[model samples]
Target: MQSQNELRNLLQRIDHKSYPAYKDTRGSYDFGNYVLSIDHVQGDPFAAPSKVSVHVRGGAAKFPADLYRMKCRRLAVCDYLLRQFGQELERVSFKAKGSGKSGLLAVSRPGQEVLERTACQMDEAKGDLVLRFEVGFPANGRTVNARELEKIFFTFLPECVSHSLFYKALDEKAVYRAADLAEDQQYIRDHLKEQGLVAFVADASILPRESGVSGRPMKDAVKFTAPESMKVSFALPHAGKIQGMGIKKGITLIVGGGYHGKSTLLKALELGVYNHIAGDGREYVITDDTAMKIRAEDGRSIKKVDISMFINDLPNGKDTSAFRTEDASGSTSQAANVVEAMEAGAETFLIDEDTSATNFMIRDELMQRVVNREDEPITPFIDRIRELYEQYGISTILVAGSSGSYFHVADCIVQMNRYKPQEITAFAKEEADRFPLPEVKPPKQAAPTFERAVRPDRAFKEDARMKLKTMGRDGISINRDTIDVRYVEQLADTEQLAALAYFLKYAEIHVFNGKRTLRESVSLLMQYVEEHGLAAVTESSYVPCGLAMPRAQEIFACINRYRRISL
Candidate 1:
């Protein structure tokens, strides 16, 4: 490796050269304390930034092994470092005259939630910590700006590395606290069934957010309190012997008037699948990792899904067993969503009445009297919810403010009042008995199959020019088509969407064949990630820094939404 001064001299000599001349700097430079490697160079200043990495020996960085001993803790530290790097980049005020994204310094930007990412990795075996980031190298039009480049590499970078990597320079207490929170969150999720619970909310947990789009907690939000009937305690590794409301593993209903915190509590539970950062107000909240949030999507495409369990016997005798639709109604779309989630291995379903189709969720006795059972084609969720738990061992947590028909099937009922939850299963049962629920016939279709065969398509092949870009947090642009994931509520961050796009491409090239089911394909991709890390998905010479782990469900959801699927 060349010395840092040698790199500086090379940059000075290359000043005023064409931007392509920057490619000559692609090599390792020894900076005494750490080694900087320019792995890939951009074609021009207008293109995506060049890939850069820094490696510090364990003795130099002085980060304790315990800080990253556990996988959860390691991911937390990586996320923390990424955030620090972003802040440091913001402070650099240098402007090298150039066009489009020129002279910019950036790292993998994190969202509200902290997740395991590939931006930073700890190599315990090698005793080295590696940080991968991007740099828009300085350029004046098409020529190199060596002075500005020197400032970025020699001055700004070393400071960022010193501040973010060293133990003494960091807030040690905050780092340990974030790691501990993540550990406790994982512990709660891992032992949910052992504690006879599907979800948990600690006594002082904050349920209300500041607004619709904000993940930050609302100021003066009421602290959650568990009713005596539903209260349960856990002995966590870090925060020992904490008490919380343990939602039982079966049909659960959250019921109350509007603005009474019913949906607020449900929203908290939905987000509990992810481990939040320290002081995020929902750090202690935990739920099953396989939980999926389901809602009605009016225009989603469905391909060969067996939604026959929920809807059958159409007016024109359409085949519900192998349903295919370009534009589905509210009820059919909701039914398809549930079946698709099941195929993707969801163990718990979270639903809110506000976003759900009214007819699909319930059928009152009045409606039963007005319309004969044979005339109605849709089998409401109320009829199959118990069967979901009893037959398939699946659990559901539903928010119902307008319907009490669900009370008859719910195994546990929690009523929210002023953001406090109280167990009201018996009271709900009494009320349900007073107002009789409609007796509905079960659909005569066979049990839905989770497996669907995907034909090998050339569109995702290595030779294909697949353009994968994230369209915010809800959608992705793949080649010429866009995959809409607005209703896939569990996709918590944009990084996951970005990673999913690449994973789909990886699957098309490496995992997918004509014989394997979509689920099998996703499993293979996940197995690859587990063995090779997230960086393995990238086919380019430069390692991407903005990838977060995505669930198999979300991966297949993106694949299914692709317009070229041949089911």
Candidate 2:
């Protein structure tokens, strides 16, 4: 077994590329030279500290750099094992946080599922555990001291591994041994079948061909480079930890309990698209030239923006004026930012639920009408993105928790849970029939509970408690219960305030708007209604009697007018 210093010395010998140069605030160049940061540390109380998370800088290229590191890791590990346990029947146990400590781990074995001849144990090892993948060794029951074992393990898979070693893990079946074309096709088909994914090699596959820039143009699509089934960590320091699974083209449902790396994965996908390198670890192999990133704009201080002014900048303005909102240009600006990325040559459209919601729901009905009319607000944006891929050959990748809306629109689905990602059939009833959704009972609204059995006498204080549950996909619901005066908060933004106001209208007309009453807010609205010379029309839009005074109408009449829309 070698010492940590010896391992570092060996790692320092590996070749690396010029570090990526970064421009500082003062415009100074910083090279992308590989820097070996401490990934994790393990030390025996009686021995030297074991440091992991080392990487050999391969080069300036994105995914290859990490791959190079992995290669160096393999070399280090193999070398260490060869030197320390050469021909020795010693049991080697590798452990991860959650993935059991010891098992019939996969080594450089020929079979996909090979079990080494040894009883595997997953107990908590004393030293730090930061080895690449898993480890398997012949068992000898000989107990090596912690210091020697740490030294040997650290010798191989040095954090400072090199790029030349990064082997892009490829499908073995993709390798063609025969010269026959039919054999090659059969090989590829068998590979796909074994991988459990649909494989088609058309003169023009819908995916590769559809993503072209001019052939069949897809609307509102996204492009990710070198999409992999499992999550790949794509940044330095963190190195090659699994981040998020990358899907080629389709709706990826990144769903899980709260804070389970769903949004992190989505953001990583966006960053990879924008930079062509891994944002943190996950990288994309973009085949096309364009990628777009779309997100929501929460700032609402801007009272007004000319919608027509921005709409005029579209490739062909067909009058989307009816869907204009307080932040029309801002909304359009968000969409346009993505569109500009596409126009400039982005094939992929990276958008989240929030941005899509704000952009699409600005004028839901009118936008839907535009989409139906072939003048898409969001969906057409998607269609055009697909057109860029399909017509001109562009690719798309969209992420959403509620992918039910995007199933028909996407070509595939990358199902992700926590950090683990797996590819599944985009359409239902495909080979993915094994991934059955767990049946969950629909969330029921609990009976109303009063804040206090008796009313409080304080006029300023409120004892009103409301428990609301918003329905979620597959019987999941978000329940919110609070006694605070949330409804009284000032309008944070037009969209949020508007949504809250609409919700309040169902409860009581005399809702709070900041510290003032709705009447005070109505006065401001009255001013806008008058300023726009829409007093008659806007008045009728809210109240049918043309009454200037605020009064509650019958619930039935209000329900009838609105047709009982629910969240």
Which candidate's lDDT is highest? 1
Tens digit per residue, CA lDDT, model 2, 1-567: 234444334334321211111000111111123222332222212222222222223232122222213322222222222222211212333321111121122222111111111111011211111112223211112211223333333433322222122223222222111112222222332333233222121211111112322223134323222235343332222222213223444333444444444454454433221111111122222112124445444322111122331233344554433222333344554543443333233444556664554444232334455554334333224323334455544455555564343444456665544434445544443533454322222222221111111111122123222222212111111123211212111111122222222333323323222343322333444454334422232222221211111112111111111211220
- Candidate 1 — what's its lDDT? 0.84
Could you tell me every candidate's TM-score relative to the true structure? Answer: 0.96, 0.28
Task: State how far residue 91 of model 1 sits from its true place (Å).
Answer: 1.7
lDDT tens digits, residue span 1-567, model 1: 999999999999999899898999999999988999998888988898888899888888777888777788878877787788778777773444466566677777776677777778876453368888888888878788888889888888888888888778999898788788788888998899998788999999888888898888889889999999988998999989999899999999999888999988888888788888876788878988888888998988888889999999899889998899988889998998888888888889999999999999988888889999889989999999989888878899999988888899999999999888989999889988998875666965778986687775686664655788998887988776788988788788888988998887787777777778888888888898998888888777767877888777788788877766777
Top candidate (TM-score): 1
For candidate 2, what is the lDDT?
Answer: 0.29
Candidate 1 has a TM-score of: 0.96
